[model samples]
Target chain A: MMQETVITNANKAYALLKADADKILKLIQVQMDNLTMPQCPLYEEVLDTHMFGLSREIDFAVRMDLIEVEEGKALLDNLEKQLNLIHEKSQQR
Target chain B: MMQETVITNANKAYALLKADADKILKLIQVQMDNLTMPQCPLYEEVLDTHMFGLSREIDFAVRMDLIEVEEGKALLDNLEKQLNLIHEKSQQR
Candidate 1:
């Protein structure tokens, strides 16, 4: 029962982190779709702020032992790759 | 046992948050003690980043139901008060 509870918390942490990453991806997608220049300072600031916030949450989860460090890194990396693809598509337009 | 585990996690979350807040306070204290101008843009940026990071952690904990929303707000508000006090002291110097 104790182990099951721990696993549940870990799963919850992972789901929350993924949801946040997806939100950032969608926000960037909307910005790109609207023709917001990727080079715009405001766009950069918004991305930076969101990324920082998500990273902090991931770090907290890792420190709390609710999520693995590698898991957190992978989540961030996956988001970055998607964002990069969007950036590339925007630049090609 | 399940209830106890949940309480343990919540206690851990609160303790971790308090530690992070204290670290920020110490960092600002050191900066002031070294006569680093609080008005400096770099100082402002550093403080902003740290506060944002801590707030993110607190938000995540609140969302996870590991801490009460009021508890999280109180933690942040208390830190803000201490930081303001430090800023005022620096200004008087």
Candidate 2:
């Protein structure tokens, strides 16, 4: 029973973190699609703020033992790669 | 057993959040004591970043049901009050 509960919480934590990462990606995508100015300082600030918030959440989950450190790092890394791709595409336009 | 586990997790969550809040307080205190520049933009930026990070952690805990919404809000509110007091003291100095 104890094991089951831990696994449940861990699963939930991973799902929540992924959802937040996706939210940030979509937010950036929307900004790129609408604003057409990836060079804007506001765009960078918004991305930085969201990334910081998500990193904090991941770090909390890791400290709580609900998620592994590597898993948390990968989540952030994956999101960064996607965001970078989007940024590059926007800049090429 | 399930109930006990839930309570244990909730207690842990609260303790972790309180510790994070205290760390932020200590960080600001050290900055104020050493730098003596509360009016500096860098100080404000640091405080803002830490506060934002803590808020994200609290929000995650609330969503996970590890802590109540009111409890999380209270934690942040209390920290803000203490920080404000510290800021005021430094300004008067």
- Report, for every candidate in turn, its global Cα lDDT versus the true structure: 0.92, 0.94
- Model 2 interface CAPRI class: medium
Q: Where is model 2 more than 4 Å wrong at Cα? A: none
Q: What DockQ number belongs to candidate 2?
A: 0.71
Candidate 2 clashes between residue pairs 3 or more apart in a chain or in different chains: none
By TM-score, how accurate is candidate 1? Answer: 0.91
Candidate 2 interface RMSD value: 1.2
* Cα shift from native, residue B65, model 2 (Å): 0.7
Q: Write the per-residue lDDT of candidate 2 for residues A1-93, one digit (tens) a residue.
A: 789889999999999999999999999999999999898987887788789989999999998999999999999999999999998999888
Tens digits of lDDT, candidate 2, B1-93: 889878988999999999999999999999999999998987887888889989999999999999999999999999999999999999898
| lDDT per residue (tens digit) for residues A1-93 in model 1 | 778878888999899989999999999999999956899987987788889989999999999999999999999999999999999989888
How far in Å is the alpha carbon of A82 misplaced in model 1? Answer: 1.2
Candidate 1 reaches a DockQ of 0.67
Q: Per-candidate TM-score, first chain only?
A: 0.97, 0.98
